[model samples]
Target chain A: MPLSEFDIIARYFAQATPGRDDVVLGIGDDAAVIDPPAGQQLAVVIDTLVAGVHFPLETDPYDIGWKALAVNLSDLAAMGAEPAWLTLALTLEQSDEQWLAGFSRGLSELAGQYGLQLVGGDTTRGSLTVTVQVAGYLPPGQALTRQGAAPGEEIWVSGTLGDAALGLRLVQGGLEAGDSAAEQLCGRLNRPQPRLSLGIALRGMASSCIDISDGLLADLGHVCAAADCGAALQYADLPLSSAARDLIAADSGLGDLPLIGGDDYELCFTAPADRHTDIQVLAGQLDCPLTRIGRIEVEPGIRCLEQDGSPRSVTGQGYRHFNESS
Target chain B: MPLSEFDIIARYFAQATPGRDDVVLGIGDDAAVIDPPAGQQLAVVIDTLVAGVHFPLETDPYDIGWKALAVNLSDLAAMGAEPAWLTLALTLEQSDEQWLAGFSRGLSELAGQYGLQLVGGDTTRGSLTVTVQVAGYLPPGQALTRQGAAPGEEIWVSGTLGDAALGLRLVQGGLEAGDSAAEQLCGRLNRPQPRLSLGIALRGMASSCIDISDGLLADLGHVCAAADCGAALQYADLPLSSAARDLIAADSGLGDLPLIGGDDYELCFTAPADRHTDIQVLAGQLDCPLTRIGRIEVEPGIRCLEQDGSPRSVTGQGYRHFNESS
Candidate 1:
């Protein structure tokens, strides 16, 4: 027997509702109301994760909850928005108490960790899918976007990239690494840390910003295209986790995975040449390693440099969900 | 086969993009940023319509689109918020052009009618479900809620009650009615008119307001429970189409439908006893009917009465989608 909609909401989502002053109404009413600071604009992002397409059919519900909300928060982080409120629309294949409890516990814990509030949402019976809509706030004129880079600006990124994508391969049993590296990568894929506070701090300083979701190179292409510029990247300067590099070297088939695989969720940003030292100082306090790996140039094409100072193409097709189907 | 995320967005929802300054960033980016007026608070609402639950599998996609957005807008209306922006997350079974075109046409037409701008959303491959999140701005301290009604206030509603429920029965072949009422009721059920403008006009006037998504008696219970007051309703005073009354007299099953069915989307509110004349005047200008059906009472329980002064109770068991599956 299936659970009723009211029971599903009362048991799962309402149980996870965060205690917050801004949420005047939560869960039960026709809608939810949140009062943000008077001077701030609401930064909203929505994303959906489907069962077979977005994750393995057997992925744990707790991780799914974390990933769904974390990914949306990552988008807000790219915009330099402070986490605020969220609404979830869940379509479940079935109602299992254990699954609901685990998923909500994971989601509520993360929401409390990020200082975010779950305001309202809807639940329906269908194939398993989760859609989370998040609303954050940024003071007027402070959001970082993809259209502000200029010639002579330096491009930088925080943390290593592609660990999440590598983790997916390992989960599918298509690849293997040493126990420690494999566990670390799989954890990265399962639970991503969104850079909210770091984003707020980088608001006025970063010239341009984009989250490395689709892949580092493909995502940077978006920023460059929007800013009407080109870029030159140094392969030696790329931030690759020691574990990822070792795993890739262990299997030649994993070559270039760091450049083309998706789901890194790190902030890649550009800054004016003069502000590099200030950003470096700021990055130290952020606890995330910041690496200046590229430069925005006046030209209109991307060029990668090998360790030998020879030009190279940093292109391997990025992960495309549609391509697999079509 | 799977679809690319970008292709999915472009094919279904990209056309509704509002391309304006208020929308600092739109669909192509990770999140959307909307600039709200300085002194106003944002009122947000989200609702989902599943294929088998909310609508019949063979129901027209155009009406589905209209209802999904309309219901969200109706939530804003209940709070006396001015509809401004909307984000949609559509989980589709497949990309059907004819269905999409009709759905888009219906959605765009209704959006244009209300001057709403579509800002951002996500499209994914999954079971057919439509979720719309709508946001509006309310003047500081003026938004109406169900928690404001006081004892001795008069209860009022805009437009006829239970027409949508009647229409649903007729549509599903559960009940038959006169041709005019059948057409009107079915239209009401399919295309609910969100009283946004009227709701805005009532902001400071209506002590408590709720959109009649649930039936009159049960929705009124929300106001009663929230405001800590009881209500007395006069059933003979209910505003109903002559066709509906005729149908009720002809069919025994139609007797309980009005009190129990849902999806009316009309505005139910309470105001000072003296405001009935003013409400009627405003109704004239709005070209909608305002019916005085009940009064808030000092006691803390519900009571209903017939024209013959017989005591009655309202059994408002509104349609529950999740309950159907259970």
Candidate 2:
């Protein structure tokens, strides 16, 4: 009477994608068939999340499934593409009915919101691993790449940073939050919301963009290397949620926690000086906070400074798969 | 002085895929960009080949690379699609230089020949497993599905079946063959020749098709079940290579080896009975053999017969993943 693969797939993982007519074949075939809009390019990305690597071993399975697709969708979001179809390569450790049901349920909810279809892939037996290959469509010559930032452009980011990392520390018992706020931050760690709408809003306006996966600084370095520009960040301008600020203010040992501790999944994009007001308007319309925390410069290196004018050399603290053992 | 991820990727993988206008972006970026042809539906398929599970543990990695992509290509072929692009997820046990060189060389050769651009995928540390996802396109309303075969249709198989299985057994020391014949069969097992040309030829002519990954009997059974019809296969009509015949004739216990042994990658399709001659002629044009091996029936199951008038219910011996290690 426990959940079979069929039961798990049907009950919680069934069709929940949004409306679209371009799909010729959806979740049931060898692959999802889509009619790419004429003159548009298809952007594809694959991301794999392994147990004990991307997430904690004791984390919720639903969060694991949700985030696996969510991160790939985040990649599509970074490129200003409309996610269409996804293929999941899942290697399960054991077939647990309860785990699969919750996992599929979480995945179904997200796929429904984005109108993305589950395409064709394989289920294999192995140590737990989820690899998702997502395809999205970007209008001709319109994809947001990381190499287009100009020296004079303003640097911007969506939503608050460091909450997820703060959540992580809280979950690990290294940091403390009040009972009310602790639950919220821990949920942030388990379910990092991908800013899909923000990506779409910045398509043409932003000169360059990348999601904050490997910390704000490390990921910003990618934009710098690709764009051949330098950056000057105003630490005081970085918008921190009251929850993150309260947690960080309480813990003095976590240096540059917001700058280096990754898993924010927010958009860090750059745009021309004149487009700031337009971005502000878009932010207001979308109901997501847009923070202008830095500016592009011709000096050809990244610079972070406090309001007191002291240089803050932020090092990368993002999870490196092999170097650090959990 | 050894191969880093980027070096191995650049030397072996990058620029190895064929350059086509449809491929807007190849390797060396965050992801790949492609444009599926206008008015066509993209067909996608991903297949994984684990060392010691799919092939002999000591089988040349070069052929492993080739067969990995080839099997995925076969799935596209079954759908009457034109090969377009592929992504590879390579999970290596270690970064062995010699193994990577051979794998890249073989994979590059196959990718170039089939007009597929190596798109985007993942690389990770794990037990040796290679997953290749292939994308193909079929003109709207023209893709041959497994559900279209009629009861009165003629079942045809392109090229030969069971050569690879025979080749594998010979290499595994289970069966003996002459040195030259063994070499040939071994090559078949290693580098499967996907019937792409035959599949394209049957796009409009064939009603239903499936690539023979599982043995002909099992795969044809899949087609029959999907099409909601039965089939009566003529045992003597099976197109067996000289190598398969010699091996089977020599072996004493490997009962009806061709019927159950799989991984042929040959195209088994059904066409209207009246177009049999045209189908054969088309096969000749492509230099690929097309043999009529069976006829569809109104009943809902497969029946294989001997050269004598007696009906024979053969034991199902097609490959199953669990049968090997699980």
Candidate 3:
């Protein structure tokens, strides 16, 4: 006989993570009770991943679970919140034990790394979809929001961008496989790091921050619109991995991908020009690469410039769900 | 051109609920930041409603939105928590403006009634699905959990049962509609009144409690399993609305539905036998009906007894997702 939904949850997900003291109740009840630390505000975010829409249908269940939580945590990181708890709503076509085990393991591993406890959720039979909501804590009045950017602030991004998009192409068979580069890009697509520590350290330094999930240009456009300002990107200074550089060199048409491709999960932020030394020191201390890619301007549109400081035309507005083409 | 995801959210869902002082930041950001009331524990719950699975494909978009949040709020009610905030993740087949309008109105109306603020969420394109996660607060050490029932405690339930199941049947064309009773039952199905006030009042009074989403027998079975006890329900004492009784009289087999059917969204709880008068007064004060239908027992299984104390056979263990018949 097939295991019942309750049985599946109990066997695979009930004990997926060790209990935390702040969790007054965890799983198996109508709701989970948590105690948030005093004097700190709570930051909450939700993201959903649908099979074939968010990831390839053939993607491993483990990667699906990992990315589901990873994406939500990245949102928290963008807000400079320390993740505390998460709840998952998983809709599966069937109660396959093997799939449940793999998904649970993947979800639990990342949750444990971030000190997050699986509090409460529902599991039902349907097409494969994963919705994760994470709650994190931030000190009072210290949230890093997009509206804080000011004109003339230096725009910065942590880690390399466009790797996840390259990985997506590799997965879609647009790029050849069987190379270390392909494997590395696929890893970035499947498990993009959240950059939580960098976000926390940049809280007081960066004027504003946002995680790059919907391509750098489009996401930067959000910061510009929020702050009522414009931005000028030094396209030459945009960080790229060696593999990405090699692929782009072979095919210059792929150059636009670093600007228009989505799913990077890297932080794009703006800071005052005088904070350059402080940011560099903080980056060294955190051991995360930080690159200045642009500067906020008084004008109100996003512009990418070449090495000679001339305007470069960029098409497309990142990934939009209801657009003709994502 | 269709509306993009961000446009849809801003037009339909961005101002769905009024701002609250506790919410430092709301929509259009990386995440929502909230200030939870000090010294209160937070109760979190998530539930998903898949079109054609949780509700009929032809169900009203308004009803779908109302029920999605109602069901999750019902879970919090069972925990004796006062709802504070919610996040929604909606998956849709297309950007249907009419559907979005109706759905947003339904959700916003209920949220306003409960003082719930829509904090943050995601909108994605996929099969029609709605996942709602609610966070409520409870006074310290006063949560009504299912594991607190003891032998000799009297079991109680709020409102009536089986109406929603009959509503489902009516919706499915299994029963004739077009009558006032049918409309009332269907209303119960479409918009369940979460016993939030009653649950808050029962915080320190009820020994154990659970919302009746999976029928009376099945949910009671959960309380029994959690408390390591059994239950004896008096069939005669089970409360029924006049409409349900009239229909059951015309079809005798329908009598069992009050026990086995699901989606009642009422609260079934246990309290000390000595607190019967206090409970009665509470019901009167809250203007809600409360019926004492059974008692916790030392035996290891659930049993139902007729008016003359003779054992009445009952089968089926409420609703179970992934079950062969469910």
Best by DockQ: 3
DockQ for every prediction shown: 0.52, 0.38, 0.76
Q: Residue by residue across A185-217, what tens digits does model 3's lDDT show?
A: 999999877999988887898889999999999
- What is the CAPRI rating of model 3's predicted complex? medium
Tens digits of per-residue lDDT for model 1 on B1-326?
54565766677667764455567666777678888777777788888888877778887888999999999999899989988888888777777768877787778778878777777887777788888899888877787888888988999999888788888878889888778888898889889989988899898889999998868777888889888889998888888877788888787567666666788899899999888888989999889898898899988876778888897655547665456554
Residues A225-281 of candidate 1 have per-residue lDDT tens digits of 988999998877888898888877788567566677888889999999888888888
**Superposed Cα deviation of residue A138, candidate 1 (Å):** 1.8
Interface RMSD score of candidate 2: 4.1
Which ranges of candidate 2 are over 4 A from the true structure? A1-20, A27-31, A170-182, A317-326, B1-8, B28-30, B170-173, B321-326
The full ranking of all candidates by lDDT, starting with the best, is 3, 1, 2
Q: Which pairs clash inside model 3?
A: none
Local distance difference test values of all predictions, in order? 0.82, 0.78, 0.91
Ranking by TM-score: 3, 2, 1
Error of 2 at B107 (Å): 2.1
Docking class of 1: medium
User: lDDT (0-100) at residue A124 of candidate 3?
Assistant: 85
Greater-DockQ candidate between 1 and 2: 1
- Give per-residue CA lDDT, model 2, range B91-131, as digits (tens): 76567879988888788888889888887776666667787
